[model samples]
Target: MLRLHRSALYYVRPLLRAALELTPSKSDTPVTFVPTVAGLLVRAQNENVAIEFTVEGAGSGAPISVPYGSLAKVEGRQHEPLELAATLEGNVFRWSEVGIPQVLSAPALEPAAWPSLPAQDCANDAELLTALREAAATTDIASLRYSLGCIRFRGDGGQLAATDGRQAILLSGFRFPWSGDVLARRCPVFTKLRLAATDERHVGRTEDWLVFRAPRWTLWLKIKHEARFPDVESQIPAREQADTTLSLAEADATFILQKLKHLPGGADQNEPITIDLNGSVAVRAKNDSSSVTELVLSSSERSGAQVRCCSDRRYLQRAVQLGFREILFRGTAAPLFCRDTRRAYVWALLSAEHCLKHNEQATRIASPRAATAVQWANSESNSGS
Candidate 1:
């Protein structure tokens, strides 16, 4: 028999929703009620992610396999305690409120069928969330290549990175305590696991699974240790190694992003925008349909170099959105680089005439030779910690 407050179920409802989101609706055993020394654990799993959380219930019996929808339908207006009493005929669980004739019942799952829980370790939530958001920004959400689509957690340098073929983002300052380099899918589940800075979060691993425990819940996802992630550090230009640097104030960058966002296309397939950094910063975008509408914005900052380059509007907007105000150009052919205190981003540059000719199917600006662009020590001074 087990007993706990009905409000406990309400508290972990968000966690349950996150778990169910990762799995199909019709899975045989979407949720399992397990009896542990700490409390009654509600757990669920799929191929990519698993979720578990504890409620203050007391009982010992075979685990129950109830549909999440069935549990979600239970109703109680006033605060009431819930009880699950073990019975002989197939282990049925029943709960009822005081002075209420209605009762809710669910069938229990056999103990032999439930998967075992693994051991755990402490994890820093603040650092983990920050790394996930930064690295996941550039990951190809729909790519078939795991290396390009998933975020790589490397233990050696305590770094996290992700890349699509066209652009990449990397962040330092993470001290992952894993055995080696591990790859995790950029699932929206991590974004939903919101917690306070003081909450206790934990991580654990088995041979095939990586488990994460929140203050009220636990999650297990498959671990990819053998995957080969690209070397993002080598591709990014050092602060002193960029040729032409263009610095934009936050207001200027935000203005450009806001203007270019509504132009024509979505994030992946957007129109090309030309950026001219001669004596000042000038941005121009045009629509060459039946009505050729042109848009231009200029900044008063005169510290820019005399270089003009074309870039995907979405990529530029993403770079600015990640708080990268300094744009570094390695000649006109090499990739564009930008960095802040802990994050470094690099994206391919597009040719102005080629994009104009090809329309929506623009190609990368070809580089004639890999020549080291001019380096400026002053560019490093703009970076903030």
Candidate 2:
């Protein structure tokens, strides 16, 4: 019997639970145990690495190896033949084992020719690289779709927009010079690009990978999720409404949002917050509990610009916290717009209901100075609602 440490036991429980949930109980699949499995071999491939494992018992036919990279964080003895206990979880095989040591083995990469990914020339590689990383972080993992002929590269580099219907993000500051109609192809390599320029310029290419480098660090990503992104070209509001240039101070936006964040159950979902631009800039928040709080945007130029729409306060807060010099809220229908003039690089759509809720809350919190700070604090305390 192998003695398990408290820490090790603690770590194994969740993994065992997950494996038990993922293993197939009804299927007859022979399990093949591979000894000397290299732990880090999966991490070192210049391109996406695929490994096949054969199961020894049960006869689900020959063992099929799926993408082992999708394993939820593997940990155990790396130098021992760690026995993987497989059980049935729904239609898949969940693996869990105890006290098995295995050495890491490098996967055999075949000498196969891979197509070249288009290379774009960027003046400042650092900025473009950073934007790619930030955009990648916002991607959804479960519903990711891949396309080989969907990669688009054009002269003058362009923006990359990705969304999964519920939420979307637009990243800009990409300037790459490539000739032709912006060829679109599937990226065949595992590419990593580090950003090192202040203006966001960087580029890199591996055997089958091309990296977009940035100023501070590099991003290693697999080129997946390349489907026809929705037609957002017509989503942007045309310049029609009387464009009001509102000067927003960073400190002021931060302070007001902080106050509005306190409303109970108000900011949850797409609850609209009201913005009263009459004499001074004001923001209001409310919840189902009938709790309301209002915050005033401390601005010097109060020309009275009023607009209301539904939005997720959390999204608005994140955009403001990113330090945009001026924020623009335009239009009232389907494809509402919110642009950060400071970065002038990213924009997002507003949620209609959230905008309306905030607007009403703002109206309620507007006049009373004595209750403003108190309400703000209480609202924050009960914000999870």
Candidate 3:
């Protein structure tokens, strides 16, 4: 059995909610809650990470038992009746679920093989979570095209990135706070995984898993390597090659996104929007009824610099959502680069057709940047040492 303070359960409870939904591929799996002397031991597949918490209280010495599959549905406290709840009341714990299997006793206990403590490679938790959340905001959920479903973390370059084949976000210097049975995680992990920023944190990697540890808790994530992450740096057109460097018009961009996001057409019927960069910016697209709608951006950096590209209208809105203060426009066919002034976070999106064609050609070239985003995150790993 395991014992934990009431507040502690409130904190880690959300994590149990984030475990991946079971699939035929089993790439996503739920956490296995095993009682341990340390506290509670939770494990995913070998490729995934587990979390352990230390419990202290008068009842800390007593054994605690949780059902094997109960981790996914834990809601530890509530004033009203709950179909299932593991509530904590003034150091006392009570649980009842309408339909779950009765867990009468703590399962067989065994020593768990834990990762080394005080991880060697580390980044501040708050900083890392900020970067990771930004990148994750743009990941694709409906399709499994390429590595679109996973966030790639580069430990060596200090980069984190995500793409849906149409648009991509790349951020540097983040420490990537990690998690879960993720009925959620695809986008929630970005904003969720609420570890305090004040705590000193470090993250390390074993053969195929990433370990993130804070003073109070630890999180591990599996390295997804079944598919290759495209070489993002090289795919982005070199700045020197851009014909027009423009500042993103936040107000105008937002107006355009709100209009097109609800356009009547289904995904299959969506049409590419064209951004005509001249003396100013003119964004043109169709509304739900296929009627042409145009918006102009007047504060462009350079006037009359002609360049044009047709891309997914929703992606343009997403670029604005990324909230880049400055943007760069290359040739009509190149992907658009929207980034912060500090160059800390970047988002790149090419038209669906162009994005696919670019990947085909990009595959023919070699990247000196790195093999994968996060299989190895340090310079030493690049040397194969």
Best candidate, TM-score: 1
Query: What C-alpha lDDT does candidate 3 achieve relative to the native structure?
Result: 0.50
The estimated TM-scores of all candidates read: 0.75, 0.51, 0.64
Better of 1 and 2 by TM-score: 1
Top lDDT prediction, candidate number: 1
Q: For all the candidates, what are their Cα RMSDs to the real structure?
A: 8.9, 10.6, 13.8
- What would the per-residue lDDT of candidate 3 be over residues 211-267, giving only the tens digit for each residue? 666665566666564656666666666556667776654444444544555432325
The local lDDT score (0 to 100) that residue 189 gets in candidate 1 is 61
Local distance difference test, each candidate: 0.64, 0.40, 0.50
Model 3, runs deviating above 4 Å:
1-11, 22-47, 53-65, 68-76, 79-119, 138-148, 174-188, 224-227, 253-271, 287-290, 298-304, 340-385
- Rank order (by TM-score, best first): 1, 3, 2
The residue-level lDDT of candidate 3 at 20 comes to: 33
Reference-based lDDT, residue 251, model 1: 48
lDDT of each residue in 1-385, candidate 1, tens digit only = 6766667666655566665563445434546777888989877766667777787777786666665555554534446777666565543444565666445566655432334456546465466765676676668867776577677776766677889878988887655556567787665566666778888666556767666667777776677666667787888989788778887665466456555665533333446766666644665455544222223333324343467777887788888887777888887677889887777899988875623222234322221111211121123234421
lDDT of 3 at 364: 24
Instruction: Give the Å shift of residue 210 in candidate 3.
Output: 1.4
TM-score of 3: 0.64
TM-score for candidate 2, residues paired by index: 0.51
Clashes of 2: 77
